[model samples]
Target chain A: MNKKEQRDHWLARPATVKRIWRVFVALLALTVLAQLAVSIKGYFGLDGWLGFGAAFGFLSCLVMVLFAKGLGYLLKRREDYYGGKEEPADDV
Target chain B: MMFEPIPPALALLLGGALIGILRGHARSAIVLLAPLATLWLVWQVPDGVALDIKFLDYRIEPLEGSPVRRLFATAFALMALVGGLFAYRQAKWHELAAAHIYAAGAIGVCFAGDLITLFIFWELMALFSTVVVWCGGGPAARAAGIRYVIMHLLGGVILKVGIEGIAVHTGSIDVQPMLASNFDAAMILIGILINAAAPPVSAWLSDSYPESSPTGSVFLSAFTTKTAVLALILLFPGEPLLIGIGLFMVMYGIIYALLENNIRRILAFSIVNQVGFMVCAVGIGTEMAINGAAAHAFAHIIYKALLFMSAGVVVYRTGLNRCSDVGGLFRTMPLTAICGIVGALAISGFPLTSGFTTKTLISQAAANEAMVLVYFLLAAASAGVFLHAGIKFPWFVFFQRDSGLRPKDAPWNMAAAMLVFAFLCVLLGVAPELLYRFLPYPVDYEAYAPDKVLFYLQLLLFSGLAFFLFLPLMRRTRTISLDADWLWRVLLSGVARGAYGALGWIGARLAKALMRIGNRLRAVAARHMSTSPDGRRSGVFARAWPIGTTALWIAILLTSYVFVYYL
Candidate 1:
């Protein structure tokens, strides 16, 4: 298959959709749970901000992964980041 | 407690030497026995008993006892045991020999009563560990071993200077907390930081670690960096710079790990990340935070070594270290895959794992201190841990689109090591008190309340969500991300080349000028020395005639002077 066809095939797969939905629900549930936990723990004289911290942490990771490609553009090197002759040209 | 006459440090050094002198299975036997003996000695030391000696009008306490020291000493002993088991089967005789010496160095550092002893053992650790790396036996391993030696030698020098300065200034060599404002303390902190794989020298870890023999990496992962963490907790707790430096390490490790394709390299970066939590905790410097750092180091050695063991097994069985070259091995190496996943989960700080039990105390300490920025950065780092190491490692190595290679499960010894650590990880997570009894602080910290568990589970599970949601961004294959060490390895190499080229250009010009001058001198000398029977300088005697005449005249003058004096 051509590159475009391969990309389209992957994006359109049912597994892809299922994976996306699973992640989303899991994230939402986690955020709500963290918020509740932090509030309750805070009331009991445990650290209060944990729930918010957890929620914030989860959100940021999502954002980072979402933008990882762009970030990779800046940070990623040729697979030959070491600039050695042994590095395969197409590996990256 | 009765004060022991024998020094633990001396015993360790002697044990290490004895192990090196032995051969075959005797080597492993000595390795195991030495640590057990050292552990016994460490446990026997009473609280507040210190071995004090006066030198150069300065008081030096080279041995001090506290719960913290005991905790670190215990971990080092545990590491020696497990690391010995993992390496005993596959390693060369010298690797086994060097491994004992290396473990001795670590144990010595734990019992080190003062900066002097600590520094001595610290350099010893560097020296012997380099020997372990060299045992991998390849050109790459050789080059890596050189770089590793250079980095550590530099660290040792800095530490020595710091120790001497503290001795001169304070008239005491006791290892105690020092403010970062003190130059001696700062020097010591930087020195230790370098060993801890903190930036900008962090590349030494990933560079040398993967190049080590599969068996050697297990030993490589345990000692040097974690010992540095132990030192930091003892000396630099509450230093604010550590907070920022550690946070940078956390994200840097995660990002680099995300970009890496080698299974072992991924684990190496994760070491930096795990140590970051300890460093941050030390910076917080609360009792709870210090407790967290100690607990985390204990848990980290077990889980991280387990992770490396799993990766080593894969590489050993299949002869591949790159993720692209490895996949579908779960079909055959199911046990290794499961253990690897367990390690990944524990490392990610999933609830009901050792990491969850230990890592949260540091985060809670930060939140309690109201360091919002640190709290956020650490939280983000937590998620990144899941992204790079948690999901990414297992997903690519074991479950990624099958590369259709099946290797047998790890050897029985390797399986035994992995299982032992995997069991410890869960056991500690589920029943933290087993490990808690060994912490530096009282066992008041709770790792698994409902709310806390729920919060972490949600955070990590969602982080996993983020990973899949951006699957397009997380594609893996063969690659390595350049880190700060690139400045030394790459940028410095380029600069050196530029300098060499400039020097070559200058040397060519200088050589041409010298050649012309030399020819002129040669012609002049030939004209004078030509043998035309009357040339200025013909034979060897002719050339020497002027010197001979001068000598004769001087002799006549001396005779005249003697005659005049007699008259």
Candidate 2:
């Protein structure tokens, strides 16, 4: 198959969707477990140490989705961000 | 008896000439060996005056005895080795050749005991690295390279002026700590800050590095700013302006990296951010803070180069650099993915990374000093690091939604280089002593106490938490963030055009006025010359009679002179 057909086939595969879902769930579970661990650790008077971490991990994923575009804007350049012709000659 | 250390200047001169003579793989071999030899020589140098010379009636000491200088020189030499290895397979022979020369320049700066030697190597670095950037071999790379050269050359000129002024005033060229209170010292500070990618000119790092070839970026990231940090440490340690400058660079790097989309550009911005930490540490100027700066520079070179190498692998394999075009490569390129993540985690200052060991000392020092605002800003900047580079880079490049590209794993050499650095990052993190011993200050800070590690993890993770909770607010992409350099690159370019246009208009008007005045003068002169006693020609000399009237006038003048003298 050509490149387009191959790409379409891959995208349409149920396995691909399932793998993506698995990743999402795994991330979620990891975040939740970390939060719980931090809280439990905090109960033993270690709140200053672990609480912020659990919270930050959860927050990073959330922010990745929320500010995905804004973050993307900051990091994104034109495909040829470094490419372009010199400015036109000025008559003046 | 007197002892002398191996002169770093000799190494640079010899290595640069040798590399110029070699070809292809031989060039890479020479480049790799040069730094190692320099490192060995640096170690062999005894703790005494190394080399001193007299130039232009001033005593120029180009090599001095100092543990701090030794540490920075060691790092630069190591950077050349690994950076050479990473670039060996793919880069052009000329690039490899020039890069070694560039590395030699950096080493020269690090080992420079005085300002004059530092200035010589400083311009050499600017020249050679611009060549490396131009090695990308495209219109964009060429244009950016020219702009890059112009900026650095301007910086070099400023530095030279500052050095000369200081020498004239102080009668010595010995490199010493300077406070930014007077013209000469302030000029030096401004000059050094420019190379450090300080605000107003910070855009050059991001603007040019991404234009470099994949391997080129790895080499590009290591030298320029770090050399400036070395200079700052040597010349302006404890100056308060550095504190503000460092903080500005830290936030500026993060915010811009957040908005940047190119994989390499984000890494480039993080270079600025990481250097900011060192600058701040230098400004603090305590033993702990200086030690932190030294250790952090050592760690940063390895990990940042690792991060760039992994990204280079991706770009090399698939020819994709934009985040929007890349995703989910973790499925196939697992090694690159893992290495990239390791680099990300290290940069984020995760518990078992090199950053954890080095970065903490600076914050701890600030806290000890009771500088509450600085402490808070640095903490927030640490969070911002996580939000921008740590999470943002890996997420978009490796773990975001699949873009369905099945590139092969990184080449064996690339993998080997990455693995070495990745292991080093962890090794340094876990065993800070290996690096601490090389620091200028004796190590007293503990990196692994339970309370400190736990506190750091919580602080960084909450920043991560903030990132996720506000993901909706961060959705924008594919745009360039404005930086202080925009004042010159964009806004000033516009202003320059307007000024030129106004000047042109005014010049045209002035020329026309002058021409009109000349025409009127000529008309009256012509009218008078043409008229005689009654509107006819008065004499031939007035209009067309040349020889006869000249003779008559000369005779009249001689007679008049004789008459006047007789009277």
Candidate 3:
């Protein structure tokens, strides 16, 4: 409806926003349904959970994110951590 | 014409020597063709030691051929070719030359038949790659390169010591797999892991690689660590300690990658992550696992280089590489975006990509060995790989909130190089048999069985969902996460700084005391005897003792001697 709204990505032009959201939701839903396709009886003490792989993947990511945030609190520093001269900012 | 059997490494090493003299089209053609010529020689190498010499009662072999060796050599040669193409137009002749020598060194390591030859090639790779890093030609590059060489030189000394011990103790220099139960083996393993960017020293890869010029980084990404991986596969495979080491590297890479803001550093971390799979596979030591390790290394160099090339293109155009400084670039740089996305998906191990085909074999081996913890951890790491590198890299650099930058797509040469590797990434995924044929063992595995595919899709896609849903958490910050390198870069420096301060303080206090002593002596001198500042002495006996004074001294010496004799 307004420029600021578009910038904020809320109340977008309905058709475009709806189409993208529909695809994202559909794809996520498809992953859940894929569990039905593959019967995953887990080994390695992670037994007895249906669709364990999906849950594990999702939960691991959440924990890692949370851990990274906690780690960032301690380890993250202003770019000057290495004396502010490092040029390329990415780390693997 | 000179007629000597040239080593395959010389094709690139010598070619590197000629690149500067050659101009324009000749340079590009030579750079592009040198790898092919080297690859051709690589294939011509016969099984077993190709060159041998006697050295102080030990046999040193410089070249050897085997499936695993050829596999590494082939990937290195191909990396050189594609990397050359990607970089030819952008990099100066010297950078390309150094890169060629660097690639040659990696290939040299792959074919090394003995510890001595391996060490030689290893040092060559070390020296030339440092040159490539220094070729960035700025203070950061210079400093990072210095630090890089320091790490490698330390590792090199440790490696040389290990090799010497192995030679003296084992009485053989052949590059055969060994256990880490002995001091020599343990030392060798540590030496190789340092180069592999394994824990406690893993930060060197992420620390130095990102500081190189965009093109230089692509070559830096390929050679040093993977050569170390190749060394592991050859010399230390099946050592169980590597399992723990590899797991540390895997988690370290993923976590650091998550916290990193620089794009290439993220890729550097992923290199450690990818190499972890190889290292862990080597620890498995079974035929399947070793093959998996070798195969994974082959696939990794291509995709990893592709990622670097894509990032290089970004830097080449925008002069910026941080996720914080870059976003929403896909609109104009569609080709780069697509290529980058392909590299990302391949790294994430999505179905129909090279990672899917290769990385699973490692986890499968873990499961086969009934290593419950290892299996589950590997699976989780695969998901983490996707999270840190797969979605995070492309999302921030390409599709996030528009930075309103319309940088052009990668130049044709770069685009072609990326396309070639991207094609290989998909090709290997779709038809893994092509690569499996190159493995040391026969292929009897299925990568795309329905159950397996379904499970992987579930794992990977859910991780992608997590990346998006946690978008707020993934926000870039103007910060760096401290890693193992901090021990040296920060703590060691800080310690040295403190030591210097203490030393300075002691020196200052000592100087003050000396000055006070000097002033007291001067006052005494002024009271008893005096001299002009110009050295016209007006003080008593300041110039010299007279003959009479000398005779008195002799009389005192005689009297003291007589008294001592009488006593």
Candidate 4:
């Protein structure tokens, strides 16, 4: 690794990166587990179940990501798809 | 004699005009001071049609004040101030002028007491925002500006027709609460929806906004759709059709945003999604829903501008916009990164952020109405928001695999503007009552209930988990996602070319047939008129055989003349 990048930032450390990810995952677990203790009063019949927020939030996002990936196959095109010049004459 | 109050929008308009003429710090000073002056003037307006004048035969109220109107005007004016602060150092002088005039148009819409005044201000906005888009200064910007103006002008024309219809049919030009049940009202609703960036016609927002200059976009994001939300709250509250339309917009924004690659275009799509929440609340049309829509509109202007400002800085420094081209910027651009994350969290409705306080109100309103399906879909869309905008934006643009870019942080004025908005995002969240006091209705909802916070935390954090889990799928491709604009940009143009070609072929055949028929007719005329004894071509009167015939004709004419004289 280059010396400049080595001293660039603490976030560049592999150990520090791993530690941050660990803490983030732990927080995610805590939010889900807290739901067991506090009953979520959902207006809809199914949403009041335990971990409903976590499950619904995760699953819906999963669905959206999958849908988007599929849509990209259909709708996504090269940057110059509309025949606009590949390089903009000026930065905006 | 008492002096009449001046219209507040006039302050910004005149400031814009002066900015065009002045140079250096004087122009910058006007940019900073005009919005503050307008803000003061906005407060001076008393409720209920503060200024009325007669135009032609009709009485028009040019300045009206109500809590909601004042609230929207305050937000717009503040946006002009902060936006001017951000752009003064970098944007072209004409860009700054156009943006201020655009701001004036939005503020004008807020205080318009009658439909005619509203329509006039609406067209004014259409005129100047196009100038802002053109200020991007490229062929792409030029083309996109034309398309954007066409869309807005089309909407303006539709709105004008509807207003004229209402005036002629109902004998009134007053702005009042109404449903879109009749033809005129439906036209008005459609017109406003186009501005709101509603689906099918909504491609204009995403297509044009990202093409604008970095500073221009920060201004662009704040005004157009929010004003439409204000107009909706004022005119079409409680319209049932809005519910379905709003739901479609919410989902449509999520899908398009998820697939988007450009940093600004992603945010642009999310604007549609965010406005969807407000449109849905207006559809609900309860007091709480109206308040929610208004509050969300205000909060949205701040946070969305914050996000755009950060994106603008990234673009300004690196001269790159695609997520694929830049990353690991947080190492050098710490302030910009942090503020961007703050804006992202606020948009995701994270606890202790402005988005949570405002967005939850819309959800709660739907629940209050027992709209089970809507509430659930909104919940899903909320998670979807975090996925596309909250995590994806920051993850791709700042923290993804390094593309070896180490650009400097935001310039001082830009940083200051970001700080101001970032502070407001938190301030409104921590003490939402500061915003709530100004709502059109009395406040009743509690945003920070323990249970509500817990539920939102769980929802958003888990969505964060999904973002990581599905990170591989979102690998930025140097590409763009096609939108409804493709229909006009590609399909429509192709159809026009084909029609022209077909017409040319038919025209060639028609010309050939006409030439043949002309020749035939000329030949027949020559046979009758010019055949001589020698079978030579000659005029009938010039032929030698005509001498005897002419004498006989003279004799016959003399005889007829004599007979007529006898009679």
Candidate 5:
């Protein structure tokens, strides 16, 4: 394909095409496997399992994201909600 | 030495003055030279008091040297140099000048041997740093600068009160590292944490910094909070409460950063997050932990400045700071993209980067002390840092679906400054010993073992993995998460407005009643006056009083007076 044609084709891929994302998932799986291959000393005895590193990292991130989302529901406000006529601070 | 060297702070103070007098290229020369001069002077002093004076039955030490002091002072001066280089081409003359003064104040605090001098320099930083914010030159900048100044000034007052309390109680004012347990110490701790952007009120950093000009944020990232870190190291080391406080800030930064849309605001939150590591280390209070805090700070200033410079380049070239607005600039602005990614990786503690070398020391300290929870939390925080800043920043700004932004890379000076700091990041990573020599304590540790590197990689990469997996959940929104500052920015203002409305209503009612009473008084006066307009009223009361009535009044007054006198 011509360069422009290829650019359009790349953009035309569906959001759920799951190609690049699949590679990332594969990497994650490989890493979790690698964590098992290595004999790593765990500071917290509970975190010394086969996939503990990967699980802990993933779960911690998941929890943080969820907690942050919860915070969003309670704390998030329209950009201009602080005052009458959007407060002209930090929007710069 | 043949003669006494000038105090290091003057290099910037006087150099900035020279910049004010000179213009154009000459001023730029001073901008670049001042920090280098300061760095040179930083190394000359021996580890003892350099200047001392007595004032009103008190001794003040303005310049003193120790390993920690030299470490912080050196890093600050280096930051001034790099930040100055990044700014001189784009910023106003006054912004550069004020920044020098701001940095000078920070340097002064580093060398302050007494609390009173520390307080003086602390307020000095608050003053000129606000001026730097004001140089941003917009309505938003103006308002943010005012809020920024108010927070710092209030912090300054709180610190002053604490200092006075300590002085009165102990009859001494020497600056010493101690736990923040007593009332005076607690106040000082709170005051310093306020400047550190510690929660539950860290929003000021995010609220004000992004408002600065692109270059201004670079300088903003370097001095104020880091100075607070230095102060904490000097004043409140080993305070257990800081562990909780620092961890809260760590989580707060990550969460808010994920929710933040503005590019600079995310970076601001990350600053709080990074400083939280130092705060935690201080609480650990071991020789290794203190060493870790000081080393981490040195490395952090460089990497953080580089990150801010990258974001600044984006804001400067595109005048767009929202993550959703710009991407895919690697085609043209390759240098900026690569440097920014390097910064992100370094901040993520990726192996072979400065963050890896420095941040691990703190975690190690936790482990050595057998604080399992602190260790785990620090590890998790390291992952979160990668998620919010390490990957998220570059992904959104440089590599996400092309916003078709093909703006040129940063200007030569900005590029040069980034390159210098970026090189330092890797150099320190590859050769940790170079940085260790300057640390406050004797070094007996290694940062990069094979297992440690593996674990950090697994943690960070998995965090990245989770990031991409949960990408939908991390979508940017056009809103702000209400922080503790909301109490002042939103709730207090709302209350004030309500009070004002109530007062207006009461004022109107009061005016009406007063008018009614005034009208009645006018009516009575007319009835009593001889010059009444109504003829009947004049006949009844307003007519001239008869001499007999006047005599009766006089006789009654005289009789009462004479009876009182007799009694």
Candidate 6:
């Protein structure tokens, strides 16, 4: 909302956000590359392949999100689907 | 011995009673002291049937101790202590009391050596948990509590029927492992599955748990499902059906949580998913699998509660439950955010967290059995867990688009509680034996092998990648995703209303017909009996034709009868 507030907030800066993403991507790359140093024996034959964890994990999550989105078509309802007024947390 | 063997659950039960009667520092002391006392008592239980009673010609083992029993009891007691610390400053006195009572029920269920004893404590859990849900204190909470109680009570009745059937057939009620090979065992499995938050009935956990008060949910998440996992391990180990059911729950929790908008509900669904891993392990039924199940249950209780605590703090501060309503909270609430991230990491089974060491055991069990499909599915589910709970929760609630709402962080007690659990999550992760030794079986498994660590790190980090990559698909909306609860909440209710209306309509027509028939009969009788002798259509009986004339008719009839008798 103000220049001082913007400066104080680290995430508010586009440059800082870009740097964080760079680190995250680098971390992802390192994990994938570490497989070259350490051979992971898999219980199933297919899982032992290079980058299998990354491929499988990424694909599984992708499929699951898609599956959930499809399910949302059939099941999603408005927040007031139960017809009661929503209340704030009881602590308040 | 310095002390007589007592049921460890009593400490919390007594504390619950005292909290209701006491006030101020005394109440606070009891709130904090009871769970610690229970934890001390839990360790005191020897490895056997420590106490028993006879009822209806049956021996009931009210207190039994085993490694598994003690482990579950320890977790319950610990949860009560930490949860009390989290809530005492903010929650209503009765809610705290009900929560303690609820924790007592879970602890009670842990040490029960016989089916009857287990059932008693099982019902105790069901009863007081409803009170905790009601502690949420709203129309939604009230309605959710009613639904929750009805489901649990139904499960309890089914379990009772099965217990009775088993007792009648075998002439014993000992808590022994059995398969669902018969009607009795099937009933028992179904009953326990309901509590395990297994499919069809699993919706109740997601439905009611999030409706509880922020503090109330922290307690609610720990006991009921984990205790059910304990019960399943004790009674129905090696049931193959559980493998399929557990897998379903694993996926079910992930999908629903993915679609969920409310931060608390997402965590609630994750409970089902995590419990799924335990259930699946129990079905594997090896010593390794059983150990894995027990250890996972212990780890799950800590991290899941931590997640709920962090979410509770957000809700407490911002008064917002939906993820869409608030973001960028990591700025103001660094402790809460870091604790939540730790919880998220632990839940994801990241290499350095509690979930990693414990959950890997279940996957290893599947691998040991050469159940290739089960192992792969479990691995994928682990990834799914990270996607839904591990990343989705913190992302939406803490780090997504700035909602410009800056709320203060958790209060001292809450933060302290989170810190303790967060520390335990890492502590167990770094040193698996701290938990592994307490497993019912010996631990030969090593969680920190180089290959295993790399494998999990890759899987989880990649899942994290998928999360950010598919962020648009996972955006929060002001909506809820329906589950099996819809059957009773909508379909069954609609059917019930229709049946009631039909019955009312049928009864009304039947009453009208009966009245018409009665009127016809009355008309015929009046026409025959009320006509005068002169044909003047006078209703003599109805109008009360002179008392004298009536007496004269009576006399004539008596005279005629006398003449006939003489004849």
**Best model number under lDDT:** 6
Ranking, lDDT, top scorer first = 6, 4, 5, 3, 1, 2
Candidate 2: stretches off by over 4 Å: A1-92, B1-4, B514-567
> Mind giving the per-residue lDDT tens digits that candidate 3 earns over B96-214?
99999999999989888899999999999999999998877777878888999999999999999899999899888889988888888888888898999998888888878888888
Model 4 residue B103 lDDT score: 95
Full ranking by TM-score: 4, 6, 5, 3, 1, 2
Q: Give the TM-score of candidate 3.
A: 0.92
DockQ of 4: 0.71
Give model 6's clash tally.
Answer: 0
Model 5 TM-score on chain A = 0.64
Lowest summed lDDT across 10 adjacent residues in model 6 chain B is found at B535-544
TM-score of each: 0.86, 0.84, 0.92, 0.95, 0.94, 0.95
State the weakest 10-residue window (summed lDDT) of model 6 chain A.
A83-92
Compose the digit string of candidate 2's lDDT tens values, residues A1-92. 45644554464456676896677556544544554444433222433443554554444444434453555545454443334732211110
Among these predictions, the greatest DockQ belongs to 6
Report the C-alpha displacement of residue B440, candidate 1, in angstroms.
Answer: 2.2
Q: Write model 5 residue lDDT over B1-567, tens digit each, in one string.
A: 566656899888998788889998899999989999899999987788888899998899888889999999999999999998889988988899999999999999999999999998899899999988888777878888899999999999889889999999999899987766688888898899999999777988998898888999999999999999999888888888888888888888898899998899999999999999999999888899999999999999999999999999988888887887887766677899889999999999999999999999999999989999899999999999999999999889987776866798889999999999999999999999999999988988877776677677778888998998899998887787788998988689989999999999999999999999999998777666656454544634556778999899999999999999999
Cα error, residue A36 of model 5, in Å, equals 5.8
| Tens digit of per-residue lDDT, candidate 4, span B245-334 | 899999999999988888999999999999999999999999998999999999999999999999999999998878888889998999
DockQ of 1: 0.25
For residue B361, what is the lDDT in candidate 3? Answer: 87
Candidate 1's residue-wise lDDT over A1-92, tens digit each?
45644554353345775897777787666667556535546422433564554555567886666555556666667665664422211210
Name the lDDT value of residue A89 in candidate 6.
40
Candidate 5 lDDT at B312 equals 94
Sort order, DockQ high to low: 6, 4, 5, 3, 1, 2
Docking class of 6: medium
